[model samples]
Target: MNISYQLTQGQIGMLISMPHNGQLIPDDIASTMTEKAKLVPDTDWYMDKLYDFAQAMGIATIIPKYSRYVIDLNRDISGVNLYPGANSTELCPTTAFDLSPLYLDGKSPNEAEIQRRIKNYWQPYHQAIADTLADMRQQYERVVLLDAHSILSHVPRFFAGKLPDFNFGNADGQSCSQALIDKVSALDLSPYSSVVNGRFKGGYITRAYGQPEQGIHAIQLELSQYTYMDEPSDQYNQQKAEQVKVKLQQFVTCLADFANAKS
Candidate 1:
């Protein structure tokens, strides 16, 4: 099946992505998932709306339509786990963060099916991202890739306590220029203090695609769902979301400006 991508062409300074916000499940796979998995609770719900400001600011975005449970587009295709020993979902997650089985009895994808998914869904999503960056680099001297994501404020399996409002990960400074990182850090989000290269020190996409010396910078922003969504329900709160969006706009615009100037 062809993966659908949303692309908004701009001057190509930075390319923003919402890889996990999708909810579309292929019919074949959907039939196998339990009711709980069908809810797609672990999705980065409403991330596309959260970053809608990108289009307004002339920043391009590439978002997938299928859910991460189908195939985690952000993961390494070689089957290597992003978190190593730490708890993490697979290419096609069999269970949720709460350890609930996603698939019904005897319906999970086997090795052959998994390989088929990798060829069909996983590879194309990443190729699109790589292509966008390549195009951006050709047009501009420097490009920044902002991988947008969100999670529940507290996932005990991953962290000890509630997470900070904004968790910026740049693969321990290997993904981007120091200036780009500093620009994001300078935002006056004092009320919601952020952590740079913390628990989520970027994902496979951020680490693999980022090449500072090559002038293709990448960073992952993991926002706590509480900052914008009503947890458990996954409802969007306009008032609370607007407050956060304003800061995000500022953060993204700064990166755009920095890229424009540097380019």
Candidate 2:
């Protein structure tokens, strides 16, 4: 079997997590899914290419190997909703973002299968994050996590209209310090709209890992696909990516600086 994830170590106090970056759906699972499910449409497309610049900045990163259709890496193992009383996907999702059924009739994984996936896939990716953060905690005074994600510009299932280009979620100030939030809020986000603690206020990873009292901070940035790619075609747009990367660089630099700063 392919490794559960790829971990790129770095000499810094930051880790960039691309939890939904995987696009591969195993054949056994694929055989049970619908044609639309086979497409893995909800996968966060091209995040590896989008964040490729992080490697040169001495930033660590963790990206999983299997599509989220297999198991959502950002969700808690207990299968609690990240956003309670709101429309959300399951730990082992049964449908796509558009509410389309992912599996064929009665082909969804059973409880035992879900447990197997948790053991084989979810645990390793999260363990990697925990281990990396532990190591960074020992090396730096402050450790930061940037949970990177991208979504369709308009997913009516979740929200009414087009999403803000950049959605920053710090779990309503539970995940990071207000000073850091203020610093981020002060950045020039002209041309592209943004909102903090908006529709998406971080997921399990950010909430679980972020502990300001422990000198660890976390934030989730959910970018709209329209900002850097042709959403319909799902193709990379160099011009778009270049333009957005300028802003992204500033955003990440701020997070890195926050991590490396002395108390």
CA error at residue 140 for candidate 1, angstroms? 0.3
How many clashes show up per model?
0, 0
lDDT (Cα, tens digit) per residue for candidate 2, span 34-150 = 999988899899888888999999999999989999999999999888888889999999989989999999999999999999998998898889999999999999999999999
**Tens digit per residue, CA lDDT, model 1, 1-263:** 34466666776579998889889898888999999999899999888888887877788888888899998888887889788788888878999988999999999999999999888877787888888899888889888899999999989878889999999999989998888899888889867869999889999899999998998889999999999888867899998899998888887888788778854
**Cα lDDT listed for each candidate:** 0.87, 0.93
Residue 17 displacement (Å), model 2: 0.3
lDDT (C-alpha) at residue 34 in model 1? 98
Query: What is candidate 1's CA lDDT for residue 12?
Result: 55
| Model 2 stretches with alpha carbons more than 4 Å out | none
Say which candidate scores most in TM-score. 2
Reference-based lDDT, residue 47, model 1 = 88
Worst 10 residues of 2 by lDDT: 1-10
